[model samples]
Target: MNILVAHNYYQQIGGEEQVFLAECNLLESYGHSVYRYILNNDQIETTPPLELLGKTIWNWDVYQEMRSLIRQQNIQIVHFHNTFPLISPSAYYAAKAEGASVVQTFHNYRLLCPNALFLRDGKVCEDCLGKVIPWQGIQHNCYRGSKSASAAVVTMLTTHRLLQTWNRQVNAYIALTDFARDKFIQGGLPVGKVFVKPNFVDPDPGIGEGKGGYALFVGRLSVEKGIDVLLEAWAQLSTKIPLKIVGDGSLASEVNRATQQLRGIEWLGRRPMDEVYKLMQNAQFLIFPSKWYEGLPRTLIESFACGTPVIAANLGAMSSFVTPYETGLHFQLGKADDLVTQVEWAIAHPEQILQMRQNARTEFEIKYTSSESYQQLIKIYEKACIQ
Candidate 1:
């Protein structure tokens, strides 16, 4: 099948971008014809706001370009990764009008919430979850903490929503978790149109022997990531278990302060994927101290594939993946003391930890590898094509 993928990339590099590229490569690796129409937010630096907004609402240029591409290439399916602030929902209509099936991956809650995070004021705020106007998001300045920016997002959503673009244009929606799928359904998307498809790690970084004695934390150092909670827990630990933090973010200074005051804590700034996988292989366990409604964190899969068990906050998708005392242990979200207790327990039970590590790898082999993900993706694509 000839596939045309559309995506609007953020200025900063992150997981979403990685997944988009990985998926493209996976499809191509299977000898499928894949074409990408990608836009980057870095263009905002030179592009005018009004021009960007006009394109975002309905890029006539993208429509014409895509329509011609569809006709020229005889594209059968259109899969969209992200379309925010640019690329627009117009791509869906354009492709559909050109007689191509559309399948979109709900990487974030952009349709329901202006910020696309469903988060505000350092917590999960679903006040605008099912609202067409997302008035609460505008009032709360959800996007970039700016009312103007939030208003723009709300405008985009409301505009497309009233036109019935989401439901009519897109043939299928891929939700990263059942929780996310239900949320989209509540937000007025057709329940039957949405499918749960978790993100997977490609190339199968096979399970490795954990040699590093210290526990590892690999992610952004932000409020929603529960870095503060992780630090507090580390501080309270009676045992001197070394902790290695790999990733940089908004809370770097604060984390630096804690690292200075706390012993047995090492803050390693952002490292390449190869280095990260190596770190995962050597670590005793990965600490996923996230406090948000995360869309299937890729780190968890990477950890599992590396034979490293995780100790994550018991919330959102993490709760679904990290079964307590099985694949990994989970602690109450934002509870430092509980995290400390779980960490200590995990450290003490060496045999159980090893068994959990084995389970973690098995989980990866069964569900999170590229081969498994490819089969699932092909099934979805075939269904979309037939529809």
Candidate 2:
């Protein structure tokens, strides 16, 4: 199979970027001729506002370039990752116009919400879910907290919806989980076109010993991530159970402050993947305090691959992987005290936690291995070709 993968990279390297690279590698490893076309958000800095806005809605350059690439290279499938501000839906039209099947992964709620996170004012919001125009997003200045920026996103979404580009241009839409798929369906994507495909950890990190006595939290330290709850829980948690925080984000200063004020809290800002895996391998359990309806975070799957049980907030995708006393424990979403309770419970029940480690690893092997993911992806590509 000849495949062309398209993505718009974020400035700060994140999970979406990881998934894009991982999928491309997986396809190539299986003998598919994969070519990549990527645009970075760093380009946004120098681009004029009017030009960027026009490109965001529809990039003629991307459309022309993609058509030529797909046609000349005889690309069978075009798997899209993130095409928010720059690549736009132009890529979708280009792929289809060139007779190439289109497969877009719903990495976030960009189609439904201007911000793509279904988050605002530090809470989970659904104001724009089923709306035709999503004016609520612009009213609240949701995207980047600027009404102009939010309006740009809303215009992009509304323009496509008006054109029926989502249902017409794209053949297959990959939702990372059942929850996300349901949301996308509600957000007006065709039901049959949407498919669930969770993220997978490649080259398996192998099971860890859990010998490290500290609990670990690895993700963006931002509001929607429930960083406040995580920090507060750590502050109140027993000092006997140390907590190690990784990753940097908008709340880096806040996290650094917490590390200084709270006892037994270690702040390691953005370690390399090997080091993160090593930390996961030795941790007591992984802590995920996300408050939003996440699109199947890659870190959670990686934790499962590491055989490290997770103590996660009982929100959408967070609760899916963490089955109480099975894979890991679930804390009440946004409740610092409840998170502390779960952490304490894990500390008290060492034997139970050990069993959870095995279950987590088994779960990963059953559903999230590279081989399993590759097979599922191939099926999606086949379906996309005929859809």
Candidate 3:
């Protein structure tokens, strides 16, 4: 099949970028022709704010590009990863008008909420979840903590929604978790059109023996990531479990402060993939204490691939991944005390941790392997084609 994939990339390289690339590669590997139509957020620097906003609602250039690609490639399907503030929901119409089946992966809640995080003031804010306009999100300045910027995002959604773009244009929508699927449904997307398809790690990092005694935290350093919560938990833990933090973001200074205050925490800024895998191999378990609803954290699957257990918050996709005593343990969301207790439990039960590590690897092999994901994706594609 000839596939045309569309995405709007963030300035920073992240899990979504990786997923977009990996999916394209997977399709090409399976003897399918894949074409990408991507827009970078870095372009925001050059374009005027009003122009960008207007284009975000409906980029005629993107539509024309998609129409030409469909005719040139004879695209049977067009899969979209992200199209916020640039590529626009109009791309779906472009594909449809060109007689191509459209499938969109809901990596975030951008269509239903302006912030896309559905987060505000360090907690889950669903004030805009089911609203037609999501005016609350605009009022709260939820997108980038700037009302004007967030207003632009809300405007795009409201405009397209009033035009029935989401309801009529897209053929299928993929959500990474059942929780996310349910939320999108509640937010008025057709329930039957939405499907569950968790994100998978490609070129699996072979399982490793946890020989090192340290625990690991690999993600952006931000308040929403619960980095401070992780630090507070580690500070109170009676046992000295060494923590190696990988990745950098807005909370670097706060992470540094925590490192200074805590004895065993090691803040190892951003590292290469191989280095991160090594850290995962050595660590006792991965710590993921995110406060917001994650689309599906790449780190969790990476940890599982390394045969490493995770101690994550009992919220969002993390809760679905870290099934207590099955794959990994779950701590209370945003609670340092709960995290500390879970950490202590893992520390005291080294043998149990090892068993959980084995279970984690087993889970990855059964669910998140590249081969498994490829088959699932092909099935989704075939289903879309039949519809």
Best by TM-score: 2
Model 3 / residue 237 / CA error / Å? 3.2
- Clashing pairs in model 1, backbone N/Cα/C closer than 3 A: 212-282
User: Model 2: per-residue lDDT, tens digit, 1-387?
Assistant: 999999999998899999999999999999999999999999999999999999999999999999999989999999999998899999999998989999999888889888988988888899999888999999999999999999999999999999999989999999999889989998888999999888999888899999999999999988989999988888888386888999999999998888788778899999999999999999989999998889999899999999999999898887676789999998888999998888888899999999999999999999999999999999999999999
Q: Report the C-alpha lDDT of model 3 over 1-387, residue by residue, as the tens digit.
A: 899988899988899999999999988998999999989999999999889888989999988988998999999999999998788887988998999999999888888888888778888888888787989987888888899888888889888889988888888889999899988999999987888888898887788898898889999998889988988888876257788899899999988887888778789999999999988988888999999889987899999999999999998888787789877899888899988888888888988988998999999889888888888888888777766
Error of 1 at 195 (Å): 0.8
Residue 197 local lDDT, model 1: 86
Model 1 over residues 1-387: C-alpha lDDT tens digits?
Answer: 799888889987788888899999999999999998898988878878778777778888888888999999999999999988778888888898899999999888888888887778777888987777888888889888888777778888889999999988988899988888888999999987888888999877778787678899999888889888988888876256889899999999987888888878889999988999999988889999887888888999999999899999888888888878888999988889898889889888989988888999999988888888889888888777766
Q: Give the Å error, residue 69, model 1.
A: 1.8
Candidate 3 lDDT at 200 equals 90
Q: Which stretches of candidate 1 lie over 4 Å from their true place?
A: none
**Worst lDDT 10-window in candidate 1:** 233-242
Where does candidate 3 stray beyond 4 Å? Answer: none
TM-score for each of the candidates: 0.97, 0.99, 0.98
